[model samples]
Target: MRVFLLTALTMIAFAANSVLNRMALAGGGIDAASFGSIRLIAGAVMLGVLCALLRGGLTLGGRGRVAGVLALLVYIYGFSAAYTVLDAGLGALILFGVVQITMFAGSLVAREAVPPRRWIGAALAFAGLVWLLWPGAGPRISVVHGLLMAAAGVGWGVYSLAGRRSTDALRGTAANFILAAPLGVLIGLALPTGAAGTVIGAQGVALAILSGAVTSGLGYALWYNVLPRLASSVAAVAQLTVPVIAMAGGMIFLGESLSLQFVAASVLVLGGVAISVLPLQGLISRSSGS
Candidate 1:
């Protein structure tokens, strides 16, 4: 029950990121680079303080630490930059689609034995994504933005896989944010979105804090805590829900329109994810044995 609740909350937080990013970006309150920078810095501050309070200090060094930090930066800046031109929900779908592919590919590269059910689920989810994102099928997706989101997806996928090996979720998460914050700032200045003349409003700053501190910082901590308990394939499929949740949030909060095609595709994608993650094989085996 605790794990379920935590995972659910984390999923909501993940979805909220897309909506919040769209809110700030579409409203012209914050530039993508600045938003990503503030998000990392704010998350770093929040997580650093929490780690200090809870764990006494931060462990800034670990195996694969550099890769983790780089992955974090890629996700932050790529996600932010992609949103400048991509619709919130579409960007999310693209992001997660690539995340699924990346993680699955990583599993293969690492010679992890992937089960057949996982392949089916991943395929279904990918097919649903393709259906939704198909040219002239649903929303008009931007190819450049799609590729950018795909990069973010790869980053997130690697980050998630890395989390499974973490000994301390809070400490590790804090370290990633702390290390990435400075790099995010530097990358922001060079990125087109981060240059001078970008507007930043109080409302945007507040939103960024919420995104960084509550949703991202704490959210990632929760996820890292839960990751070790789940199979890699299960975790990958579980995140397929984010695009649907993000789209719903966009409609409710951002006043985006919903289409029937989206609903159908969502159902297909979710069904695939469910099939992949559920313990159907176990149930079938038990029933047969009984």
Candidate 2:
């Protein structure tokens, strides 16, 4: 029950990131680079404090530590930058689609045995994503931002896999944020400002803080804690819920329009995820044995 609750909360937090990033960037409350930078720094600060409070000291070194930090930077910056043009719901779908593909590929490379039903579920979920993102006339997607979001998805996929091996999820997450935060700042410094009238105000800072501290910082740590117990495919498929959650949040908070297509796709995606992660195989085996 605890694991189930944790997993549910983690998905919600992940979905919330889309809405928050869209809110900050689309509204011109903050520039993409600065928002990414602030998000990383804020997460680092929050997690650093959390580590101290929980463990009495901070431990910053671990296997795959460097890769984790680099991947995290890729996810943070690419996500923020992509949202400059991508809609919140659409971006979440792209990001999680790439993430599912990347992790599926990684599982193959590692030679982890995957059940056939899981593959079928993944295919269904991917098909649903395609249906959602299919370019109609007057499509709002920007080629540049779409590619950027794809890159972010790959980064997040790698990060999620690396996190599965962490000995201490909270400490490892904090260390990665600490290392990545400065790199985010450097990348921000190098980029030329593109959007006019972008400024960070009190509301932006507050939203960023909530995103970084509660949703991202603690949220990522909690996800890491759950990752070790989940199959790689199950983890990937479960994230299909994120886009649906983001879609609803966008409609409610960002005043985005909802379509019948989105509703139908939501059913497919969530149903596929349920098929992948539930205990159908176990039930079948038990019944046959009896």
Candidate 3:
């Protein structure tokens, strides 16, 4: 029950990241790149302080640290860039869908055996995602934006896998953010002419800070703490809630409407993921054996 609650809270925080970004960007307060850079810097600072207070200091002198930093960079920039054009709900769907697929792929690559039922469930979830996200017959997504989001998904998957080996979640996340912060800032500076001017004023800065320090930095640490206690399938299935939660956040906070199609798609996707992840047979067998 505690793990379930923590998972729910983590999903809420993850969903809020989209809501906050939409508010900042659509309001003309911040550009995607600038917002991304600010998020990394602020998150780095916040996590650094927390690590210092909690652990007496911070260190990144391990193999996992290097992987975490690289993955963090990919996720931060790719996420920021993808949102420049994608709607909040659509972006969340793509991001989380890709995350599931990437992590599934990672599991295979690592030789972690996946059961047959899990694969079927993943397929159902993917099919539902395609139904939900596929554009109408009128137009298609830009290749560039699609690639960016895909990269972002891969980055986040790598980050999750890297954190799985960590004994200290807070310290590991802090180190990754701190190492990646300068790179994010440098990338922001290197953007084309007039790009930097898009991010403006205090409101934008505040949103970015909240996204970084509260939702992303702290939320990631929480997730890391939870991962070891969860099965790979459970982790994948749990993330299915993020897009639905993000859609709800969009409707409630951003005045976005809940379309019937989207709602239906959500049901199918979430149900399929749940089916794929739950250990129904294991529970039943244990009960019967007992």
Candidate 4:
């Protein structure tokens, strides 16, 4: 029950990050580059404080440290920029779909023997994503934004893979945020004038801080704490809820409309994820044993 609550909370946090990003960007409260920069810095600060209080010191040196930072930067910037054109729910769907496919492909490349059920599930999910992104007569989704979200998803998948062996998730994550914050600032500064914006109001800054400190920083720490307690399949399946939650939040908060197509695609994608990651292994074992 405790693990379930923690996992649910983590999923909410992930979903909330999408809503908050959309609120900030779509509302014209902040520009993409500045929002990304603030988010990284705020995340670093929050995580650094958390690590110091819990572990006395932050660990900055680790394998894949550079790769993790780079991937994180890519995810952060791409995610922020994508929201400028993509709706929150749509963006979340794309992001998670790509992430699921990327991680599954990575496992195969590493010679992990994937179950046939998982393969079928992944294919279904991929088809759903393709259907959603297909050029159609429905409300148009920007190809540029879709591509950016895909990039963000790939970056996040790589970052997750890099951090798979972490001994201390808090400290390692803090170090990555700290290292990336400055680089993010540089990226923000380098953005074109139209992209970065000239003025940042209090509301925008507040949203960024909340997204960084609460959703990104503390939320991830909670997720790491819960990860060891969850089965790998359970972990993957649990994330399928994020897009649903984001969709609901988008409709309520962002006034985003849900098209029939979006709904259908979501059902396909999430249902596919459920099929892929649900524990068929137990059934397989029982049948074989019998």
Question: Pick by TM-score: which candidate is best?
Answer: 4
After superposition, candidate 2 runs with Cα above 4 Å error: 1-10, 137-140, 222-240, 267-273, 283-290
* Residue 5 local lDDT, model 3: 93
Clash counts for the predictions, in order: 0, 0, 0, 0
Report the lDDT tens digits of candidate 4 across residue range 201-288: 7888999999999999999889988998998888977888899899999999989999888888888788877888788778689899
65: Cα error in model 3, Å? 3.0
Taking every candidate in turn, the Cα RMSD to the unseen true structure, in Å, is 2.9, 3.2, 3.2, 2.2
Q: Which candidate do you rate higher for TM-score, 2 or 4?
A: 4
lDDT of 4: 0.88
Clashing pairs in 4: none
Worst 10 residues of 4 by lDDT: 192-201
Per residue, candidate 1 scores C-alpha lDDT tens digits across 1-290 of: 88777788899999999999989888889898889999999999989998888789999998778888999999998998888877677778778766766777788889998889868877887787777667777556676776788789899999878876778878888999999999889988887854436677997888888899989988877787797887765675568678888988888988888777767776766776666666778879999999
Q: Which stretches of candidate 3 lie over 4 Å from their true place?
A: 1-7, 132-147, 192-197, 224-238, 283-290
Give Cα distance to truth, residue 140, candidate 3, Å: 8.0
Best by lDDT: 4
State each model's CA lDDT, in order.
Answer: 0.82, 0.81, 0.79, 0.88
Question: Model 4: runs farther than 4 Å from truth?
Answer: 137-139, 193-196, 281-290
* TM-score, predicted candidate 3 vs. hidden true structure: 0.85
lDDT, candidate 3, 1-290, per-residue tens: 99989988898889889888877877778887888999999899888988888789998676688888889888888887777665667668767766766777788899999988768767876776677546662124555665687788889989978987877888888888999999888987786424457556699899999999999888876787797898876776678778888888888877876666766766666676676667868878999999
Between candidates 1 and 4, the lDDT winner: 4
TM-score of 4: 0.93
